[model samples]
Target: MNIKQADFVKSAVFERDYPEELEHFEFAFVGRSNVGKSSLINSITNRNKLAKTSKTPGRTQLINYFLVNKEFYFVDLPGYGFAKVPKEMKREWGQTMERYLASPRHKLVFVLLDIRRVPSGEDLDMLEWLDHYGTPFKIIFTKMDKLSNNEKFKALKAIKTKVDFHNDDVFFHSSLNNNGKDEILNYVEACLNGEVE
Candidate 1:
């Protein structure tokens, strides 16, 4: 769908702090700390700073909400598996994300994975958690601009070997060149329209 107006609604860590518009659907974005979740959101929404892009990995510590087209919500769940953060903080982030996922408003989740790196244990665990909970999710392989076509082919093959996923369930995205942006948005539109599962 076309995102004409994307605005930052609020940052929430708990259910009570979320926007009261329960009628609207919610799409959540989640990934490792340095996997470029913010950049992907900005690129998809065509906003430069809709979600903060930071040089530091673990900057987004709270669940951020953005209203898109004044209709639905883009929930930016905090990044996980940042090595430098305290163990307690990491655990808290995991719990916070689980709490949000448990809510009924969450329609779909876009799980971003860096193309240049192998999916970590946390990444695999997140995918398993989504599967176990029966949450609909799409895997996004981000930072496509960093790899050549041949390198990308091999990287994707390597990742597939480690993580069992269907070709239709994944998208390659690049924030710099806007690669796979349209396909991703189209998939979102399909999901919102109940055209695709």
Candidate 2:
């Protein structure tokens, strides 16, 4: 989808005070530190710089919000697991992440996983937590361009064997190549409307 205008809305410590404007549907992107969450957001929105991409892990320490056409909000939540941040900062980040996921505001969260390698400890933990909490979420494996077609198939198959994903639910995407952009957009849009696509 062509984002007419995408702007940083606000970063909230608590979900209640996130943004009073619920007129728009909400969707969030989350994963481990530097798992290409920002890149994925930019790719899907077709905005090369909508969300800041950083080589430095854990650059996004806050719950960054972006509004797309005022129809929905795309949230760039803080990455968990592997931040080289300070001990005190990491503790606070964990707390922030828990609160963010547990809150009902924008209940639909998209957890991005790196397809180049198997899901990490924190990645699996997040998925399990979401499942335990009964939160609505979907897993999108990113960085498909790094793998050959045969390798991609094998990697996807491996992931499925481990995770038990339904057919339409799992996706393969390459942010650089702009693959699966349309499907991701449609999925998020459907979730924003509170309906299964």
Q: Please report the candidate that would top TM-score against the real structure.
A: 1
lDDT of 2 at 91: 79
Model 2 clash tally? 0
lDDT of 2 at 7: 77
TM-score, model 1 to reference: 0.95
Which lDDT tens digits does candidate 1 get at residues 16-129? 988886464578999999899999999999999999999889888899999888888888999998648899998898888889988777578999999999899999999999
TM-score of predicted structure 2: 0.91
TM-score of each: 0.95, 0.91
Candidate lDDT values, in order: 0.88, 0.81
Residue ranges of candidate 2 with Cα displaced over 4 Å: none
Which 10 consecutive positions of candidate 1 have the poorest summed lDDT? Answer: 18-27
Would you list the clashing residue pairs of candidate 1? none
**Clashes per candidate, residues 3 or more apart or on different chains:** 0, 0
**Clash number for model 1?**
0
